[model samples]
Target: MRMLLQIAFIVAAGYGALVAAAYFAQAKLVYFPAVGREQVATPAQMGLPHEELTLRTKDGVRLHAWYVSVPQPRGVVLFLHGNAGNISHRLDSLAMFARLGYATLIVDYRGYGRSGGRPSEEGTYLDALAAWRHLTAERGIAPEDVVLFGESLGAAVAAWLAAQVQPRALVILSGFVSVPELGQEVYPFLPVKWLARFRYATADFLKDVSCPVLVAHSRDDEVVPFRHGERLYAVAPGPKSFLELQGGHNEAFFFVRPEWERSLAEFLDSTRPVR
Candidate 1:
């Protein structure tokens, strides 16, 4: 009985240490800007024409972006990527948007790719706002003709921006309700809700967003569970949609491209103003 108690004590101590480590290292776990830092490919490689842009945020951070254009564009997509990799890794998505006759403006958040500064929750929101201003102000794209498309962590940034700017539509792919909520889900054994330093509250922001919303998630997603998407959709206002995707978190968009394109096209059509 003494030996069993000793073993239990050791196990408890180890678990406590793990929770402490997770608490301190939360920022490192949230952002992955260092991964795939090299510029892998460009829009030209995918047979798409693009213009490199350097945007200045309100906080004076200079961000790098790519404006991939399509002829007779149905609309423009301001693509905010996930917490991982740089913009160079998102050429496939740019090409896909181009195929759908939507010009894409994908930006590397601060500290990712060619952009400057370190990654932070507030920094990402500022980075997204810079991209939005570039599209609406510099490029002369009307708010009614602009779509905010965010994946994973970017969904939170996009939703926050959508609430303020009132873009034509907002698309959240593999999104979570909030950082603390997701952390709690991912590390159920730990006190993740209290440990989280960042609060990218996507669902809360969705409540303020008046634009049409599309929440897509994959049941097989190993990273973010499908219920996050369901919850986000439930919280979104009217003219909202929930798309069921297949494959893991990263691969779901690529895996269901054909179906995604079809559904997205239909959804975009519905958002058009009736003459």
Candidate 2:
């Protein structure tokens, strides 16, 4: 009987340790590295003059950003980047939007680049709202002239923002339904829903957003699987579109294939008014 009790105690302790390890490693596992990459392309490389801007959140967290303008600008794209990198890592995306004749404002969330404050789900949402206010209130850009583009974790941030602001259109790339859902998928043994501190519930908020949406995911994506994108696309309201690409998570947009750019351009064109 003593030996049986000892064995039970050992098993319980091991399970407890596993849970603790997963809880502590949650943030680290979710956000990857942003440093040690080559400098991102600049507007000069793309033959454009872009303005650098600093925005302050209501909570006094300052963020770094860039605003690139295009000839006969179709609209403004408020870019919410993925979890791992700062705005510099997304220069290619800005260039793509510029090529499509849309002004792009790419901002780094809290705890990224020169941005202030540590990152949390609510904090990132606040940071996105601050960037939006800077563009609409300070720059005088109307809501109807803005497009929200979010990638990976940024997709959740963008979904929350779209629910509140109702932009001209919304785009989610490599996004997930919620952090808990992602956690459950990665660690099936753990009770993720109970332990998760940051719940970026993009799926829960989709029903509230009334604007047009475009969700893009890659079949080869290993980070956030394509099912998350499909689920988000399925729950979104009318006038929505989905694109399945050939590359992985980060490379999907970077591949620069004709089909990728063509699909994006076609989606953007669909937003225009019929003459």
Could you give candidate 1's per-residue lDDT for residues 187-217 as a string of tens digits?
7888888888899999999999999999988
Q: Where is the poorest 10-residue window by lDDT in model 2?
A: 32-41
For each candidate, what is the lDDT? 0.89, 0.84
Error of 2 at 194 (Å): 1.3
Error of 1 at 195 (Å): 0.9
Candidate 2: segments with Cα more than 4 A from true spot:
33-41, 252-255, 273-275
TM values, all candidates: 0.93, 0.93
